[model samples]
Target chain A: MYLLLDQPTISQSSGNVVDGINLEDIKEFAKAFKLRRLGLGLTQTQVGQALSVTEGPAYSQSAICSALASQMLAAQLSSQQQNIFEKLDITPKSAQKIKPVLERWMKEAEERYASGQNHLTDFIGMEPSKKRKRRTSFTPQALELLNAHFERNTHPSGTEITGLAHQLGYEREVIRIWFCNKRQALKNTVRMMSKGMV
Target chain B: MYLLLDQPTISQSSGNVVDGINLEDIKEFAKAFKLRRLGLGLTQTQVGQALSVTEGPAYSQSAICSALASQMLAAQLSSQQQNIFEKLDITPKSAQKIKPVLERWMKEAEERYASGQNHLTDFIGMEPSKKRKRRTSFTPQALELLNAHFERNTHPSGTEITGLAHQLGYEREVIRIWFCNKRQALKNTVRMMSKGMV
Candidate 1:
């Protein structure tokens, strides 16, 4: 079931609230997410760049990872080819053993959402990396291309990048870079827009 | 062009830099956005909520608005929905216009971006007012009906709520409430998703 958090004055301790979050947990979650967004070079404003600018109404700095977020927005802004399963939300004890399970998990999530279970809640006790190291150089052009591609693909029938590349008069490799950078860029942008990743 | 903010740390400047942000005019620009988002009852995280969680990344708390200083986050996130007519790095008066100019600015920005300009040099400005209060109330049946209609409408030629409500034996008022509530629910969901809000 989806949650409603309209009341801003969230009680720190009600004693009876189920699955309720506490101030201490809030602080811990906040710190980790903050470090990740910044360490990953994402700012909250940038994360919502695609959503507010491209898809829907604007949101605040928080609300990045809650499964109860916008379904349409998620579908609209996601990196089509970038599997959500690969996101570092859940950890696997062994990559080999968990590969199939991971794939199934993706399928299930997609189906569940499609079947109208908009809010997802299982994370399998996954852990994010303490320090992630992604070393790559990307340009703005690359980001634009990928963003365009993801947006287009979210539609029923996808478009061809070859024609797009030809129109833009750039190399295919450049276009590929654009998609790669675009996904990362979107991720950073999404995170920033969601939680306030400083 | 788009900018790739490098992970490389820039040495803090004792002589000119205002805590990594050059304040001269940016401060006023920041203030304008602060007033805008807050006036709208938006926290920083709420401003960035539309982007990624609109898609479906997991939730994070701290990292959501972590990368942006409150001022900058407020400025950029507040203006994410609107377009900018000036450079973000310019005088606050120039940057402060980002909020009001957003919608028109976004179209222009898209055009300019398509033509060759990948980066927006300025953050947009806006005028926010608590007077522009959003409607967030909905009856449960209305919400259920609207969501049901949404599911149907997702198909190629999905049904509209009016038609669905008729089929579901509900009145037009009920359907309208459902739609209103659904919209708010979606927006609220996005709000929560940003920085993994409530």
Candidate 2:
């Protein structure tokens, strides 16, 4: 079901209301939620991590233990999760779906705070049991080669990327992402220069 | 010289001062410049466009007329020019290099404003004579095919991108950028989901 939601759509017409919920009300709620979250001295990351544990199905014990094994992955994953509020407002339907869960969580957190359970972890949950692959850093030589290829052709085939990866001694996935980032950088530069030119 | 400035450098050590100019002063100036720009009811784009005309060499009359030919390109280029302030303070040396130009331009603007020459164009120069390629919007079928390819292999070589472009009846460049944006979107989704998992 979640995977279905993840499928890309070119556009989602955001009407004034969705699922009998007013867009205006959701916008107001979003603003208020941000203020309330800040007032509690909690970050979006903390809320996201906490909500996963409390609202979702528990991962198996083995999965939880695996998450605990890599502190670096935990930190990386936590950084990635820090923008839940922004994500919620992407579409009216999504905002409507997430509102109730957030409202309930915020209320529980406030109640705990009032009752003197001030430690953030007390309400937010134990440390997140999530892991992520480490960031890839390319060598300068590899970057030069990649840039040379990009200058010639912005897109490379799966096989070509695999070949480059093998030649550069990096993961094929890393090489692929590098191309994507490189293209983005080129687009941005052109955009910036066009600004000056225009 | 400008090209040299654009060279990729892994790191630039920003100290408290550079070339007898204080970093603190530059930071304060950046803040003030933003405020002053706002006070003039000016956007960063307007300033960037204005600066290109006023501070740099005239981009040949032919180039300016070429820019005038395409209104769509002009609008696109204008949007890209926005965010000059953020770009200024990337490094202390860069900030110092640009500070004088911005300061002089602001002073001239203020003088013009005080004298009742308040029309933005009077100081900001004529509309930017810049052009950019039109944005590409992919069909649903194209996107579906692209996503399928991405799932199998995020990187597609030049030949594959050209083939897809021909198959879809779109420009090869557009198809390549589609792959790039798709990859970025996937990375962002993974990051967002990781936040939830953590």
Candidate 3:
């Protein structure tokens, strides 16, 4: 049931609907969001930073990329228009998901402004109390085990990742990300070496 | 001259050429590669693993995705056919770059086989001497400084990354990747938290 719920659906229809959400509605919201944000005198970077300090899900560029790619594929949007549309930085699915979050934030900001709290920081909510999780520190032993596993198989299956996470007493997601970063490191090394050879 | 050489050109011609490399040539090579690997009784996984051990650029999935996405966009391939064609896992640009490397490896493997070296390990060359660089270890103080900077700004410019690397005595590339991984971690945390809320 969980798997069914999580399954990704490829929308083939031309109506621009994905996951039962209207893409047209999302496009409208994206335009309105930009205008509203600008009216509040906030930059996208400022909003992103502020959201990190609040209880909202912080916007990451890759998240936007994934959502946009999937949405663009579904919507059958022209490749030429991709650059212009990217300014919105919110795809149909992500726009639908984040609509309420941004709406609430905008409402709060407006209320604060009306109440004479006009400072940029006052509405952006740079509260230090709501901090993100601290960076995970791997013990030397754990690192050894991880490196050994990586040497054996750079791409581990989900089961292998979960098993290793259990063995090392870390979150499975952390283990998965460790492999991801390790792969990126390996790629970078290969690229640098290739350049040196050139 | 270097900047001009490195600039990415968006192929506007309908001749299926990108960066002066023909897409049709890449498609042909991709098809032949699958057949050649099968003739050697090797799976794609085995080939990927073997390539990593050789003095060749390791094939990271993201590298393939980026190359493939760009190629597909240029080729204007139907989105429906993406999954079917993804098996090749090599774009025109990447195929052009890596073709010689793969061809060399294949030639050596065939030579060894003809000389009666049937062992998979012998041909794969799983030598420990050609190991990838050791994992980078960040000191506790470095971590503190990185975290402090991250709190101030999650996305740093190239100049900022170079400066930070110099200050910490790490490679600029390593610092760049640290920020990338940190952003991934933040995204994963936000995703997990959103799920928990639901």
| Comparison by TM-score, 2 against 3, better one | 2
Task: Compose the digit string of candidate 3's lDDT tens values, residues A34-129.
Answer: 556555555454466456556443453223323322343334455455552343233455556666665666667666655654345544534454
Ranking by TM-score: 2, 3, 1
Candidate 3 per-residue lDDT, tens place, B1-198, comes to 112122333334446554567565544444455566677766554565577666555655444333333332323433333331243332334446655665677767666666765556666744433556778998877777776566446666678899999999999999999988876665554334234321
Fnat of each candidate: 0.08, 0.00, 0.00
lDDT by residue for model 1 (B1-198), tens: 111111122333223232233332333433444454444344554434422333344333333333223334223322322221121222233333332332232344344544654332222222333364355555566555554444222211123545765766766556566555544454464455455432
Best by DockQ: 1
TM-score for chain B of all predictions: 0.24, 0.49, 0.43
Top candidate (TM-score): 2
Ranking by DockQ: 1, 3, 2
| TM-score between candidate 2 chain A and the true chain A | 0.41
Give the 10-residue window scoring lowest on summed lDDT in candidate 2 chain A.
A60-69
Off by over 4 Å in 1: A1-198, B1-25, B32-159, B165-198
**Tens digit per residue, CA lDDT, model 2, A44-154:** 445655665677633211111111112212222333553432321133454456656767777878767666544444566454533443344565777789866754556
Top candidate on lDDT is 3
Q: Which residue pairs come into collision in candidate 3?
A: none
**lDDT for position B7 in model 3:** 31
Error of 1 at A107 (Å): 6.5
lDDT of 2 at B59: 45
